[model samples]
Target: MKRKLCVAPSFNCDDDMEELNVAALSSRKESVAPLTAERDGTLFRHSLSYPLALVLRLRVLQIVCGISTLVMGSVAFIEERQKFNMGLGIPAGGFSILAAAVSIHTSRGWSLVTGGASVGAGAAGVLWIASGCLLIALIVQSCRTILDPSGLDNGDGEAIEDYRPSPRDLIVIACVQIVLAASTLFSAVVCARIDCTA
Candidate 1:
């Protein structure tokens, strides 16, 4: 007796396997994780609790400096009694006034611009001593504020809910102010010496 060879039919399931593979890939693509944290991960969100207070203080100081510069500019104009010098003083005063107004209006950009203009005018051979003194005061205040951080915090027993500038930051600001003051004073002395010899 001869035995017939048994054969099984081969099924075409390539399409089904392809579909399953596509589905698996799609699911994996949909399950991706975020690269960053949801909250407090943004750059601006870092240490923003006390920015308002700091801004306010800065604005006030800028206003004060601007006003002082304006006064000094006026004095310079009177002392010089020259048309060109008088015009310069008027513009400087106007800029200082504008800076004060901007600071009061809460426009930080304009205020900063005006503050810079006021300082520049002072540095350009007008009201040197007053500008130097103001800078010195600002530096001293910055140092005091930095060394005593408690003033920024609420004295209540509740949890501290605000950000106060660190002593280190204060020290840095102070150093910068001191440098500025010294430079202004030096410039003023040199100007005076030159004027005396001339």
Candidate 2:
């Protein structure tokens, strides 16, 4: 989507002109304070551009981490299923995949709700917090699943060696899950705090 950025025009400004412009801008914001509640489009109100880039970078990282989580979990789950006699029940890998999908959807759909036109704050808050908690749980589950030097995992440390899945994939999943959880939670907090309605 094309964001309508508020850009200050460049002009050869004398000291007096700059002071007048600053005063005018402050007065303008004071007038619109009731409508915006002092909330700016960017997450950081102090600066116009710095945190915007940081926010975007963090969001992109969150998306990448989610995708990697899905791919690694799927690969490990498939390989482990073939190697073991597990039932049709969903495992941590399955939950990881599910959470990855949720993370992707929430992160992508986040921009849509910034205008407060698509969804309400209450509903969005619930979804964001839910997804954050889900990812945190996944991190815990992934951490529990570790393998020794024998190249054998006990299926997220739940069962014995015979039931465990891929050990190598677990490492990748754990690392990616950690990154995903952190990035996602931070992004959600920013979303809840910012008011893009301006």
Listing every candidate in turn, what is its Cα RMSD in Å to the true structure after a full C-alpha superposition? 21.1, 15.5
Q: Which pairs clash in model 2?
A: 145-156, 155-164
lDDT of 1 by residue, 2-102 (tens): 99998987866998899999999987766653333345533343343323344445545544545554454444334333323222333433443454344
User: Of the candidates shown, which would achieve the greatest lDDT relative to the real structure?
Assistant: 2
**lDDT: worst 10-residue window of model 1:** 80-89
lDDT of 1 at 183: 45
The C-alpha stretches of model 2 lying farther than 4 A from their native spots are 1-54, 82-118, 147-164, 190-198
- State residue 91's C-alpha deviation in candidate 2, in Å: 12
- Give TM per candidate: 0.31, 0.43
Q: Across residues 1-198, which tens digit of lDDT does each residue of candidate 2 receive?
A: 999989987776597798999999999988998868756664522335323444455556555555555555555456556432111112323343344344333442343434323324455445455556566666665555443412353567554656555567656645665565556556555643443421
Clashes of each: 0, 2
Candidate 2 lowest-lDDT run of ten: 84-93
